[model samples]
Target: MSAEFLAELATLTDPAGILTGAATDGYLLDQRRRFAGRALAVARPRDTAEVAAMLALCHRHRVAVVPQGGNTSLCGGATPDSSGQALLLSLERFHGIDDIDADNNTITVAAGATLASVQAAARSAGRLFPADWAAAASCQIGGALATNAGGINVLRYGNMRNLVLGLEVVLADGTIWNGLRGLRKDNTGYDLKQLFVGSEGTLGIITRAVLRLYPAPTAHATALVPVAGPQAALELLHELQAAAGDRITSFELISAPCMALLAQHFPALPQPFAPIPDWLVLIELADAGEDSALQDKLAEVLFAQGLDEALLAQHASQSRAFWELRESIPEAQRLEGVSIKHDISVPLSAIPDFIEQCGRALLAAYPTAQIIAFGHLGDGNLHYNIFLPDHSAGVYAEEEHINAIIYREVAERRGSFSAEHGIGQLKRGLMQHYRSPVELALMRQIKQALDPHNLMNPGKFLPD
Candidate 1:
């Protein structure tokens, strides 16, 4: 089987033995290292024609394919399972960019281009890509589109779904679907370009994409505001929305305990904010109009919030210093010890109650368990991770029960178990347990329709 498949691929692609061995050191494992899996080989295809040939070979040989880029998935989405039946298809070398239309504000790029690379290309062309993620340096555009990633700038520019205009996907049968049109308005039959976005690479392989661009912001005003709690933060979000509207680009919520943990782990950076406060909000304002007064509007809204105390950074450097406090929380927590993470989301109004009740429940179960909750509150998403103080014994062993405790509560509140992160193998069973039968059945139908042989991605999003 190996000889037949390698010879077939070699006839159609350069470096046919590229699927052999030792090329997947960093690309095979995940960030958590919780889900390690085996694969037949790692296939690196530099162009769409090569991708089609590889897929055709895998399809004929009855081998499962796992499409991977940057290998930075937080929820084990990109990594395959221990079953050696799967093949890892890495698209990292398909990095090409073109400024198709400067006046029309559109750019086409190969799917493997890193987010930072695309953003830099846009900036060099005097435009902005607008979609920003914390892992921009490592995460590629293909992975971002597959997962429909949301990040800090989502408040104004929207998620990956909103930024994409067209896609080029290779079908399950090795047929290339070249739907890469840059038209702003086209009422064509299917609008099939959207079918691949957010599909988690199940429908097909996204080889390239056409993206919309915006004029670069001429001015940037940032602030780090302190609030009493989620309620105050929500109230402030409304106030800023009414005042600055689209100019208020990003509004983030950070908890006092989260800040304290960073100080505990990374002592090099002094903790600027007091820890007694309950919640904090990081506000960033930007405008394309060079004369826009975003700073004055932000200050006015924060001062009007009589219930909360806010500290706006006087300069861009100071604002970034404050933002670093929030960014470092995840890394510091990782440095501290093992943690059971839940990338969950509730309604914008239900955030405070969710946090309060979940913390109380954890305390009731195990008082020493630390509940580290922080994320993009403006968009109604929070990273509610559980950290145990007694890391000496059976810490990871407690993951199953801890998940049940939190997930049950999440189901009770009608919240999403996996919000921004796609469900790889980690939440497979929970999805079946919580999702309505009708919803699960529809997903299965879609899966069967697109990939009848179950070759696209065998066991990731949908539950068996």
Candidate 2:
């Protein structure tokens, strides 16, 4: 059956695009190595026409197809199932920047282009593409849009959904929907592009996108300040935003546990202070004007508020160093040990309360657990992760309990269980447990409407 499907796929794709054996290994596994999927073949398409033809063939053969990008999905969204019955579709060859309209502040980019490439293109045109994450170098623009990713700059510029003006999608039946209108205001009808933006390829494949750009920041000021706790950190966030106005581009919350993991694993990295503070907020301010005076304004606000213990970056290297420390937390944690991770968001006002309550609850339930909490506090999203220092026997068994305790608190405060990460294979069960019946039914209805045969990334996002 697989051979027959591959023979048909070869007719639409080039010889270089087909991968039969070991070549499909990279696309078969996820970034975290949590899920090892199997694929009959990896079909790399050069353009939208090839992709459409390939999908049409797959649909005709009734063979499942998985849309893969960089395979950097934390939730196993791009990885195929273990059945070896699916074809992994790769978009690497469709690499091109179709257009860069500097006058309109928009760029037309292919889905295979990396986020870093997009950022560099925007910079080359004297503009900025604000959507960024740690995996920008390897993650593709298509996956980012599919996941609706949010990163450091989400506080100022919005997520992938907000930055995207239009998209070119290949629907389930291999029909092309070219809605790549770069206009800012178009109230024609239902925003069709949005349906596939965060759809995770369950509905269709994103072939190209029209991304919005911003004026590049000419000045940058970054600072690392110590705080007493989450409450104090929230207070500092408010103060800095009030003083710096829209210049406050990033406000990251780093917990003491995260600092310890960094110190223990990555000793060579520069420490923010001699003894790490219990809590720290890594703040960054960017401005289009060269003489924004961001550093002076930050100093004034911190000193006036009696939060004087701070480290300010006077140069570009120092600013990078500060960001380096913040960015290295994930790697440090991975080196430290296994952890139960979560991406959650709450009301800006309820962040402090949520942290305190969730921490108290988790500690009471598992005494040896350490909360390695950190994330973009300015956007009210936290990577609330848990690690057991003692490595108890039942730690892994309590994964469900840990998730329930945290998600229950999130529900009480009207927060999201999956913040920036999309509900891929990892969180599909959680979606079934948390989402209201009506919401779940609506999603299934849409999925059936778009891909009634379920040949497009069958076992992801929506549950059976």
Best by TM-score: 2
Candidate 2 regions exceeding 4 Å error are: 390-395
Candidate 2 lDDT over 1-464, as tens digits, reads 77787787888867998998988777888877778889889989999999999888888888888998878888889999899998889888887899999999999999999999999999999999998889998889998999999999999998999999999999888999999999899999999999998889999999999999999989888889998988888998888877778888899999888888888888898886868888999999999665347678888888887877888888889888888888999898778767878999998899999999999999899888889899999999999988887544345678889999999999999999888988889888888778889999999999989999999888898778
Candidate 1 runs further than 4 Å off: 16-19, 290-292, 307-309
- Highest-lDDT candidate: 2
Question: Model 1, range 1-464, lDDT digits (tens) per residue?
Answer: 86777666667656743665666566678887877887887888889998998898888898789999888788888998887778888898888895557788888999899999999999999999998867989899999999888888888888888888888999888899888888889997887877777777887899999998998998877777778788878888888888888887788888887888887888887576665466778888889654336677777777777634566667778878877887888898888778888988778888888888888888899889988889988788888888888653357788888888888778778888877777877877787788999999988887888789999977787878
The whole-model lDDT of each prediction reads 0.82, 0.89
